[model samples]
Target: MEATEIIIKCILIVVIFAISLVVAMYSTYAERKIAAFFQDRVGPNRAGPFGMLQPLADGAKMFLKEEIIPANASGLLFIVGPSLAILTACIASAVIPWGQQLTIGSTVIDLQVTDINVGILYIFGVVSLGVYGIMIGGWASNNKYSLLGAIRAASQNISYEISMGLSIIALLLVTGTLSLREIAEQQHGFHWNVFYQPLGFLIFLVCAFAETNRTPFDLPECETELVGGYHTEYSSMKLGFYLFAEYINMFISSAVMATLYFGGYNFPFMDDLGLSQNWITIIGVVVLFAKIFAFIFFFMWIRWTIPRFRYDQLMNMGWKVLIPLAIANIVISGVVNNFLNNA
Candidate 1:
């Protein structure tokens, strides 16, 4: 790459990292606030104005807390688990098309950090590896509860990944590309895939919740049964890493959902307004985040509203229901596309 291009890529990576950190931090506050609202109670209002500084306080507290490594724990693996989880979560955002490219003077700046052709596949690959973090951490702790939590995470992610992949197949049939940027470009403005592939969207959405280990699909961390799930033995920043990674994964999943199904960064009447390319790109980025936050809120709302599923029920729903539905959506999409082309 040219020096300028390399510099730009570095800058983009830094920007995305910063954005991901900030979003993950605030999502904690957002989750609490949403949870409180759903329960008809006030959320954190003590940290700052409307609890704006709550995440900062939370971070400080976690940092100041004493670290603990269990007597029987594999200390190295225990440390590695949360690090892997956070790293995997951060990297998944690399392939997402955050916004359209912008031209500044003579140089072109892509809003995404990277636009690999196999972007969707890359996302799937990285997301699949996230389970290892949980598994390693849980196993290393040498606690039966942690081991069970890790097992649950492994099975849960593996089960849902199949459906998630199948759901993407349907989208691929319609878009004829696996590159997320191309998909986003094809879905300019209101011509979103959600209009055409509603079933695929639903399947993907459910799998996303499962992949992120959110509520209803959060059997891995069932407090009642697993004693804080996989990270039960972790304390201080180690525990914080696991928790922060969850929110970061949530943020990334929200971004991916917006990009894949809701037309990332695209808005109705966007082209009609005769806006500059930079401004248009900026608008799309903002709109994408708006959509992401909406999904995030929906996630929190569901967490508060729904009950956790039994382990068997979670597996049955993922493997039996979502997988079959995703396959059907793919077949239907292919048939319709073939007919449209021949006609």
Candidate 2:
């Protein structure tokens, strides 16, 4: 790559990282506001105009507070646990296409960091590794509650990941490419994959909730029974890392959903705008984020709306319900594609 291109890519990388952190931070504020709104309370209005500065205040508190490593805890692994969680969460956005390429003089800037051909598999692999962070943290804490939470998280992610991958299989059969950018490009101008793979989308959405350990499936960190779940023994920024990672995962999942089911940067009536390439790219980016925010709101809404599932119910839904539906979707997609290709 030319020096200018390298510089540009580096800048983009920093920007992407900052955006992820900012979105994750704000998601916490949004979640609190949403929760308060649901419960008919004023929420954090005193901090800074409807608690706009609450995240920064919370973050500062986390950094300033004392960090504790229990005498019984494995210090190295304990530190590694939260670090790994945040690391995995941050890196998963690399393959996501943020927007169309921008033309600046002779230099063309693609909004994505890297477009690996096996982007989808890369996502699945990285996401699978995220469970290790929770497992390691909980195990290293040397607390029974932590260990139990860790085990629950590991099992939950593994069970749902199967269905999540199977659901994606149907979409892959339809799209014929594992590259996320290619999939997004194919769905340009209102031809979103949701129309073709609605079942796959639903299965994927449910699996996503499980994967992220959101409410209704948040058995791993169930506050009532586990007292704080995997990070119960953690404190200060070490604990902050784990919590921040969850929000980051939510943000990334939102982006992935927007890319997969809705359309990454594609929008209806985009062509009708008749705008310049730069303007079009900006608008597409806005449209994509709008969808992402809507999904994020839905996630928070579900967290407040649904009661946490009983463990048996959570397992049954994963194994007996979602997995089978995902399998059926794959079979149907295959048969339909076969008939279409044959005819």
Candidate 3:
């Protein structure tokens, strides 16, 4: 890459990182507002105009709170846990195709940070590493509840990841590429995979919710049973890191879902309007976030609407239901593709 191109990529990465942080912060406020709406109460109206500044208030409170480490805790690992969680959450977005490319004065700029060929595999690898954060933190705390929560998180992620990978296999078959950028290009102008692979989409969606430790699938941090779950012993910004990481993961997962199945930044008739390349790319980015916010709202809605799953039920769904269905979808997709190729 030229010097200007390299500089532009770095700038884009920094911009994305900043944007992700802000979105994660606001997601907290949005979640509370959503929860309040479901429970029929006002939420966070005092922080700023209609609670716009609630995240700032929450961050300040967390910063001002006492930092505590358990008496018998493994101090180094205890610190490492939430840091790993937050780091993994932040880095997973590197492979996502945010929008189409923009050209400026003979220089072509890709919207994504990097377009590695094995983008999907890279996502899976990073997602699996997320378990270490919970595991290390829980084990270092020397608390039974924390350990149990860590165990739950590790097991849950392992079980669901298989189904999630299988679910994506069908998409890979259809798109014939593992690169997210290529997948997005294939899905231009409403040509989304969701239409052709509805079953795969459903299974992937469920597994994503589980992967992110969201509602109904949130067995790791069951408040009544685990007493705040894995990060129970953490306080101040350490705890803040763990909690903030969850929202970041949510945002990343939402973006991934948009890219993989919903057609990232694609809108119908986008080319018909004859807009400039930069304008089109900008519009695409906005459309992509519109889809992401819709998914985020859906996530919050489901969180309030459903109850947490029993551990056994969660496992059974992952293994017996989602995995098997995903496998079947893959087989069906392969057969259809083979037949189409021969015909």
Candidate 4:
């Protein structure tokens, strides 16, 4: 690669990384305010104008809080757990196509940092690695509750991931490519895969909730039972890292859902506007972010609305309901494709 190309890639990576962190930070503020709205109460209003700086204050508090490692804990692995969690969360964005190319004078730049052909698989692999962090943290803490939480997390992730992968198999049958960029490009002007793959999208959405350990599926961290779950023995920014990783995963999951089902950066009449490439690229980026924010809101909305599922209920839904549905959807998609091709 040319020196200029290398420089652009580095800049893109840094920018996307920074954006992920910012979105994750503000998601906490958004979650609190949204929850407050649902409960009919004032949210954080003390920090900045309408609590704009509440996340910053929270960050400072986490930093200033005393760091504690249990005497019985595996010190190094305990620290490594949250670090790995956040690291996987951040790196998963590398394969996501943020937008179409930008034209800056003579130079062209892709909004994504990298466009691996197996982007979908890459995301799945990274997400799978995230569970290890929880497992390790819980085990390293040397607490039974923590160990139980870790075990729950591992089992929950494994169960749901099977259905998640199967749902994507149906989508891959429709899109015919694993490259997220190609998938996004194929979805031009609202020809979204969700139109044809609605069942697959629904399955994927539910699995995303389970995978992210959101409400209705947050059994791994059932405070009532597990006493803060895997992080029960954690303190300070160590706890902060685990919390941050969750929000980051939520953000990335939102992005992936938007990209895969709703149309990544494509909008209706996007080509009809007679806009320049640069203008289209800018609008596409905005549209993608809008979709991501919508999904994030939906995530938070469901969190406040739904009660957490019992561990048994969670397992049954994953193994019996979602997996069967996913398999049926795949068969249906295959038949449809075969019919269309024959026609």
Candidate 2 regions exceeding 4 Å error are: none
Clashing pairs in 2: none
Candidate 1 worst ten-residue window by lDDT: 96-105
**For residues 258-331, could you state the per-residue lDDT of candidate 1 as single tens digits?**
99999999999998999899999998989999999999998998899999999889988998899889988988
lDDT of each candidate versus the true structure:
0.93, 0.94, 0.93, 0.95
User: Could you say which candidate leads in lDDT?
Assistant: 4
- The lDDT of model 4 is 0.95
**Each model's Cα RMSD:** 0.9, 0.8, 0.9, 0.7
Weakest lDDT window of 10 consecutive positions for candidate 4: 211-220
Q: List the residue pairs that clash in candidate 1.
A: none
Question: Which sections of candidate 1 miss by over 4 Å?
Answer: none
Candidate 2 — what's its lDDT? 0.94
| Candidate 1 lDDT score at position 88 | 97
Model 4 steric clash pairs = none
Q: Mark the 10 consecutive residues where model 2 has the least summed lDDT.
A: 42-51
Quote the lDDT for 135 in model 4.
94
lDDT of 2 by residue, 1-343 (tens): 5899889989999999999999999999999999999999978887888789999999999999998999999989999999999999999999999999999998899999999999999988988999999999999999999999999999999999999999999999999999999999999999999999999999999988998889988888998999889999999999999999999999999999999889889999888988999999999999988999999999999999999999989889999999999999999999999999999
lDDT by residue (125-161, candidate 4, tens digit) is 9999989989999999999999999999999999999
